[model samples]
Target: MMKTTSIIASLLILSATTFAQSWTVDKVHSRLGYGVTHMGISESEGSFKDYTAKITSSKEDFSDAVVELTANVASINTENEQRDGHLKSPDFFDAAKYPTLTFKSTSFKKVGDKQYKVTGDLTLHGVTKPVTLDVVLNGTTTNPMSKKTVAGFKITGTIKRADFGVAAGMPTAMLGDEVAIRANTEFIKD
Candidate 1:
């Protein structure tokens, strides 16, 4: 009985260690973007040029994971230099003061086979609010060159600029309050 107990305990420890893992974001294959309606007639799209994401999980399927991301507000690009500058000014993100926008996942719930509902606190313009994102686990594979496990995910969500105190000169009639957020991220197991 004693020998059997020792064997079971060793197996349990190995299983626990095998399940827990850490992943590092591969910026080369990741993109974070946002879109907003302009003048209720057109839509403008932009992307952040600098960001980082770290994820930790213990589940084999990544059902239990903690995710954190941060983006540089000053790196906002909208294809137009002038507009991009304006977005970084005090009227919008106030990049000079709050230079970084961050998100930290509080909970992750599996809604489908590869779909998840991720609820987290998003901090923008110095204000934090709860946001839920629909996330899809694209897939996981082993990198041929790096010999590391890689995973891909697509996430989508929406947030109100006014809620985060980002409504400076952006009036409702001129600019939409809701901003659509989308991200395609790849991670390498570390």
Candidate 2:
């Protein structure tokens, strides 16, 4: 009876350790940013100061990973106080009403040696829509200080602001309809 119980416990431990590894964003080494053309001339850029993201995978190559992220709209920063305030108002994100934007991956498919196509539902400005993003796995390594496994990725995509009812009255000549999204993220195994 003792030997049988030991065998069962070992199996359970092995299964748990081998499947469903969870990774969390290392906030200090990650950034979520966006860019939009201003007045059809120069590009305006901004970034969210607060966000949370997680990745889950059972495969070593992260070919079958699922990613989910949430960012606080109020944390938008463009280094300009007035513009940031306006973005938080009803004209744009309406941070008071929406509070946050989110993304949850529906499909994560490996497209190349270190590239992936991630399709997910993005909820922003009180609207939910499907969006696809390209992800490039920079690499994975062990952190010298913590001795923990860490993975780096870069994600890029573009979304139409009008589709999500963000700044519906804004014209393309003033603020470009397409917002370019980019994020450089580092995830630590948990």
Candidate 3:
């Protein structure tokens, strides 16, 4: 009877694994971006040129998924030349000092059929902090261009820029200490 029970347990575990869906970001349709108040009247927009993301989800539920992201700090892009240079300098991101920004999932809970609250540790500019993202699972579909099954999601939230050791000069009249960030990505099965 013990041997029979062990065999049944093994079968259940295998079945659970088989039903899970795992995917990696499809760079062509994925985007990582952020917006910050500039001069208190305007907003500054920027995005990282290089990033990698992965998702391991169970088609059965949103709570049964893991999300991860890694971004290259040097990939920061804003339109201007001088400002971008300054941002990359020691006064701000100091990309030379910290080359990568990473995030690993700590929890993923469902808020709706396609909405989720994802909490994780975000490490940026040499600082690590917990952050929560309001994520919307845009559902899954087949991409004609890539000829692959893909899942899309829109993840957004804000983090205190200062908390990430990115606090430089925040001119209240121009820019503030808080920054708004948004990331949208589509993951494809590997």
Candidate 4:
């Protein structure tokens, strides 16, 4: 009886795994970038150099999917070393204390033919807040060499730095409060 139960359990696990499609972020072909107004004159853009993302879904349309991601806070680069260092300090991201920023989706709702409203909890600088992103499915294709199915997406959102406890002493005239986020990512079926 014990052997029979174990065999049944194994089959159940295998069946569940077979039905859920898993996708891993193709980091080399993906980017999570951010832009903000600097000095009320120009926009400063940057991107995290290291990050990881995973997606699991049971629906072909991906409306029932779940997405999770983590970005290394220390990987921030803005084309200026001094400014990058400042962003890593306690006054900013506090990279030494909080080395990673993370997000986990609570819901993925289809809004249009290829558009979605993704609501998730974003944690940064020791703070967690609920935010919604406008996401567009850029379609999917199969790689010739690996023959793996690849999916593309464009996600856009905004978060106030002060709300995430990332506010420094910079005046409003010097820096904008809202950080505009834009990410273009490709995921490969695993």
Candidate 5:
């Protein structure tokens, strides 16, 4: 009886781990982006080129996925070298003080065949906030070069920049307080 019990327990544990698949971020194909109001009418867009994320999915399907990501605050770029320098100053992101931003998913639920809701805690500038992202699973495909099983996903959300100590010009209550955040990531089974 003892031997049978031990065998069953080991099998259960093995199945639990096998039922999930792990993936690493393909940084070359992934992008982190944000948009905010520039001067009341125009919008400013920027992308972070340096970031890393890990994900685990049940059966290698994104519908049952969990993910965590970390981004370097100093990697922010808006295509303008001058503005990029300003963003790293005290007037904006202040990358020198806080060098990293992180996100960890708490839950992932399927809303449709191609859509999902990912709820996570985002840490920025030392502040952490709970956020829910609308995600679209762009489907799975094989890479021509690597010939590996890859999944694509797009997630978008909004957060109050001021809450993370990014309030440079948000002195009054009239201007927008939230910034649109988005990310596109491709993951490969590891």
Candidate 6:
């Protein structure tokens, strides 16, 4: 009886570990970008230079994946020093008060082939709201140099700055209320 129990316990442990897989972002190959209309004429683009993201899943297709991300608000870079500084001020993200913005997925549902709808709670500027983003699995492959399994994903969505009280007082004419998000990320299995 004791030997049989030990064998069963070992199998259970092996199965549990085998099923749950974790992946970490390959930061060098990833980008978290955003865009906003400027003066109703052109678009201004920016990106957070510092952030961390992870993916956890138990299924091969990633149908049961959970994603989490955190970005430093002070790392906003628009290529212009003055604009970047202004964005970190109270008029926008208020980086001093709210140093980080985060997202935790509530659901990751496969909508079609290699496509999914990810719904999550986004916390920014001291406010939290549910936002849905569209995600496409670009591809998955084994890296020749690293010999590690990697997955590529593209995510796109829009969120209203007012919804998170970011630049609440700014007029839509000067800076569009809607902010467009585009993220291309590569995750390597651990």
Score every model by TM-score.
Answer: 0.90, 0.91, 0.91, 0.90, 0.91, 0.92
Would you list the C-alpha lDDT of every candidate in the order shown? Answer: 0.92, 0.96, 0.85, 0.92, 0.85, 0.96
Q: Could you give candidate 3's per-residue lDDT for residues 87-113 as a string of tens digits?
A: 888888999999899999999999888
Clashes in candidate 3: how many?
Answer: 3
Give the per-residue lDDT of model 4 (tens digit) for 89-170.
9878899999999999999999999899999999999999999999999999999989999999999999998888785677
> Which 10 residues in a row give candidate 1 its minimum summed lDDT?
164-173
Mind giving the per-residue lDDT tens digits that candidate 1 earns over 55-77? 88998688888999999999999
Scored against the true structure, residue 174 in model 1 reaches a CA lDDT of 94
Local lDDT at 44 for model 2: 98
lDDT tens digits by residue: candidate 2, 1-190: 9999999999998896689899999999999999999999999999999999999998888988999999999999999999999999999999999999999999999999999999999999999999999999999999999999999999999999999999999988999999999999999999
- Model 6: weakest 10-residue lDDT segment is 12-21
Off by over 4 Å in 4: 1-17
Pairwise TM-score winner, candidates 1 and 2: 2
Where does candidate 5 stray beyond 4 Å?
Answer: 1-6, 172-175
Candidate 1 lDDT at 126 equals: 94
Model 3 residue 45 lDDT score: 90
Candidate 2 similarity to native, TM-score: 0.91
Clash-forming residue pairs, model 6: none
When 4 and 6 are scored with lDDT, the better candidate is 6
Leading candidate by TM-score = 6
Q: Candidate 1, which segments miss by more than 4 Å at Cα?
A: 1-18
Model 2 weakest 10-residue run by lDDT: 12-21
Residue 56 shift from truth in candidate 2, angstroms? 0.4
